[model samples]
Target chain A: MSAEEWEKVLWKTQSYPDNHIPARYFLASLRKNPNFRPYTYWPLVLASCAITQHLATIYIFLAVFVRLKECSLDPRILVWITVACFIGGYLAWELLNCSRSDTARRNANGTKTLKSSILVFLALMALSPVLKTLTAATSSDSIWALSAFLFMLNALLADYSPAKLGGQVRERLTSVLSMNAAISSSVVLGSRLSDGLAVFALILFSVQAFALFPMLRQRLQATLTIFQALLTLLLSLLSICLTASLSATVSCIYAATLVAVTFVAPGILVWAQKYKNEIRGPWDVAVPKVN
Target chain B: MDPLSIAMITDFFHPNVGGVENHIFMLSANLLRKGHKVIVITHSHDPDRVGIRWMLPSLKVYYLPYPTIASSATLPNYFTFLPYFRTIILREHITLIHAHASLSPLGQEGILHAHLMGVRTVFTDHSLFGFEDAASILTNKLLEAALKNVDAVICVSHIGRENTVLRGQLFEKTDEDPSTVAVSGNVFVIPNALVADQFKPSQIPDVSQPSSKPLCVTIVVISRLAYRKGIDLLVAAAPRICSAFPNVKFVIGGTGPKLNELLQMREKHLLQDRIELLGPVRHSDVRDVLVRGSIFLNTSLTESFGIAILEAACAGLYVVSTRVGGVPEILPEDMISFANPEEDDVFRAMSEAITIVSQGKHDPWNAHKRVKGFYDWFQVAERTEKVYESVIKSDQRDLWTRIRRTMELGPFAGLIYVVILIVNCVFFLILEWSIPREDLHFVWMHWNRDYFIELSQKEARKTSFI
Candidate 1:
């Protein structure tokens, strides 16, 4: 039979057998990698900068905890630094809002932020005494292990997307989970402190690092790729310097991890693009477009 | 062709009342009529449906006592199925095993074990699946391993054939062009066929009857309310259709997870009177529902074969379906209307169908006659018999060839499945020793219509004499 005589319809009885492979266009509707968009090395590295920033935050939090735990750093000085970082972060946030020309809700947001900050400060002061002795019964080794695992969980589950900013950016469940994990790690580590003030200072620093810093980072991610890369570099270097003062081996490990996340991982991804075979066709479940 | 002792192995069968279940029953009945023996092997339904049973016209069903994980599919335990499978195949004298539905673990395991019994194997994929989803990726690998040594593959439609070919990796390098691959020649496209007489058009009254009120052009939708069935499109389009055409009404049947959404659409739009929901209509009542409306609307996002649309068309209702998988290949262009699976497009198609229906351009009885000739179960049986005959004539793959073919799956998965293959053979050997073929009860006699009737009459006369 001629190839033209073989129509794809099922209702009719064509002379060809049921197993006939058409001489032309067999399995013609199959579309391989139809929506393929290959990733470039540099662009993927830049996109993965969010992961680098998240890892830096986690490492910096650990360094702060280690300093407070060993009683080597003054809690009062740490609290003063937290206050200064809070003021500076607030100014930067205000600047971001002004540049986006979102002044209509500025007064409302400022008052709300002021109320929440004061409430958290007073609450932390009240909770410091209880938190300092919260896990006194648990061994120090268990506390260290738990905090390490929790920090890893926070890094793994954190929301790394750039926020649109200037709108009600609804928090994702994963981001909430990530925040809780980091705060829980901070509490367990703070409970290992010798004094209540150190616990208070560490808790305050954690609230800034885990909660406030992520929102600021998301807004900053929208600014420029160069800006994000520079911030990632600064944070990673600070984490390495702080860890080096404590231990050389830990600092080297952190540096290697930072380099892997920022450069090596993205290179592997760019190389792995050749293996991506996304077979799409009419057989895929259609996403109905509704008004 | 000589008679084949064929075992229809699937996880779906009677009392389940689904497309696969009905297809197996109908095909088995038709094959029995054609003088071949057919037996169904499926997981037993809950509450008292276990062991061997018989349907009309000598379609024997063996409801194996196996629990299903979800959607009536047994867990794919590679070796455990061999003991039961071996005993059934040996006793029933099954020369070939035909498995249905890719999701059925019983079917895949049957294909994996059939070669060990020295029986030829044929597999039919009844649905289409995307290759990108994680579930599809894992299941497709499993399917690839299961289909590696099967004698033949059957698909319900052309699109389904493509999906199964890719999912099963049923392709080889072409003879002329070694660099290019083609779908294997053994893969066949045998479409699902509906019994048209069951969907015969009723004697619907025309405008000439002059009843108390003028008849309205009703649109009927009969499908399970599921996301894949595109119920969201219906919920979006129903209100707009209601306000656009006041005389047009809807009768939606079948119930599923999306039922609440359809109910909410009806309530929010205040279309309670305009839209009627017949919760869970039986298969026998589908034709009655189809005959109530002049237009049959199907809004499925993905369909392997639109059997519902064919049933509607056979019942004389003009079909207006979302132009989806294998649906376009089912009927002639004039008999149905197609729309992209979008709200505006479906609304457009629905309005056009309404106009066509109201203007009397589409005739129901004429459509019934046309569709009646399009598909028949007996014809499906004959074509399937051709596949079975060819499969039996083909050489069965040896254990070494099966191992080599299984090795082609990939490095990681291929090694894993190869281990499974060897382990399965060892287990079969163990079963052969424990439950030897000599001790197994063989089915020496089958149901013969004439002999059974004569035996029954003789018993009746003896009872009367007593």
Candidate 2:
């Protein structure tokens, strides 16, 4: 619209010609749709791997639980298997941590401390009996309800990504909800068992799977090559298979799920995200200084 | 021509007080006065005023119950809001969707649905965002996506426009036809408007005259005590400024997470004698606070319009503010003193403003006239109405006359989306075929949407509009 046209009608129609485009005007100056970057294959795949690995680990843990429940597997044998895997994973992680001379780049700082782990172990040990008998007085239904609530809390609170990672806190919190439920379920089951040794074994497994494994997974991502990751995944799958032999149907189901999880889940998630294509515009509030 | 019907979209609105909320209220009220049909779409906070409640004659507000994950922003449940938003538009016959604030999920969701429904989308940026930081980057990306098909962007100042263009990466490498994604010229600079009549300075006789003792000058620092507000600078400068000038006393107001820090400073400096912490005075009482002071101190790191400064100016207080964001453009040099967002600079500026008042360089009468001349809701309403017309006309020129008119559409909207979707699907299919869903364990949904909806809806409909 022309200056005359705009001026003539602060409220009424003007004398300016129709189709009189204002040159270099504010609206015209805006690039209608801008700054959209297409996602490449490799980065998308890498991002998916974070989800993939998490699902695979969850499956492996479920497979272990199934084996323990059905096969009547020797507690000593399962403990040994878990210890060997932990030691190997630890060695691999330490080497990776050492190789990355730039400590700043490495995410595995202060987190993998033996002291912290020991302290956590002591704390958990101290709390387990209290945790076991503490809720015993409550009705079974309420206990169930409370356990479910605690699991949800754990899921909400768990940080999947370190501060350096790209995912939002909310996203990571979502990822851990399943893990929280599984661990809490195991704890409830452990308390139900008559054997204290069985309870201890289950508790140790829960700690490894929930608390310790996520940190290891992050380190593995940071430190390992594709070949090494594949190799580790293969080994983890083998252990899952061995563990599965102890429990037939449930373990078989879990093992199959692990394969599907490692391959399909990430790809599906990426696909969904790509299709949705979140469009953000100026309507969003500007993050202001609190000052 | 008839006044345009506008759907003002914001996450925050009346009952919730903030810059964006106040902006929407004032803008809508003024637009309504100009005979425009203005309805607001925001998430419900109050109960009784939930869903559709008429705020004024010809001004209706539709409150949507979207889950707020943090602060007041909806969870960006994009497609979830489309149906209701569409219904609201159809019923109200909303010609334009004018969204305020760039980081709000509800605002972005409104724009997306508005675009899908073939309505004109105009976004107003109320604050500046930096290029750096993860949160800002994500926000910028979301803003970029939202702006992809928007008609035009309204910035409060030239600086805000520049920041938006740069941070949004609106300009990048051009296509073969030299077609850019978007141009910077689409940014309209419309400064904030104030109800000038409401801010008319009270004629208190003997207020500005020389007293028996040296004139007691009050420096007002009224804002949330937060890092962004540069409250630390105020906390640091309060003691020095007060100690340097015994005649001057500090009246600091507003509260935030940094209130404890301010209190600590007050306690440490023994400033109970010199400084007064008013502790979060109401918006209605802002003028009462301002009129008590000779100089208004705004030690902010960033500001969109510095509406508080404008309000202070309207109250005839000399604005001593940091020259950051849109603040530098708000007032002329004589009526205000520009300071860097630092303790030394703020202190210096405060001293300078005091000196200028002492020397009678700035007449209170002249300051009032300048303020009245600069900002008024009527003028703002007119300019905003012009924006509405121009934006509507622009949309008429750009929007497809037919649903499948590819000629008017660009690559980003049509072909690229199809290709990207196909490619992603192909990859997903391959993964699925190679892998298996039966083998994959499904994770249950975390939060119950239905439960939250019922609760929020009940709260929205039940609460009184206080």
Q: Against the true structure, whose lDDT is highest? A: 1
* Interface RMSD (Cα, Å) for model 2: 9.7
- lDDT of each residue in A1-291, candidate 1, tens digit only: 656478888999888889987767466777888888898999888888889988988888888888888888899999999999999999987887786666768888899989999999999999999999999889989998998899989998998988885676789999999999999999998888899999999999999999999999998888888889899999999999999999999999999999999999999998899999888888889899999
Judged by DockQ cut-offs, the docking class of candidate 2 is incorrect
lDDT string for model 2 (B1-466, tens) is 4767689998888778877888889888888777777889988874555786766434678888766677787786565665567667766667899998887888887766665445888888888776446787678767776665567788776556666776555553346555545444456667777776666565553555634232788888899888788777777788888789888888988989899988898899888867888998888888888888878888777776788988888888888987776676677667789876667777788888888876656556567777777677777677777777777766343333222332223555545433432453354455446545454433233233357679888888878553
Model 1 clashing residue pairs (backbone): none
**Reference contacts preserved by each model:** 0.88, 0.00
Please give the lDDT score at residue A152 for candidate 1: 88
Residues B218-283 of candidate 1: C-alpha lDDT, one tens digit per residue: 999999999999999999999999999989999999999999999999989999999999999999
**For model 2 chain B, where is the 10-residue window of minimal lDDT?**
B400-409
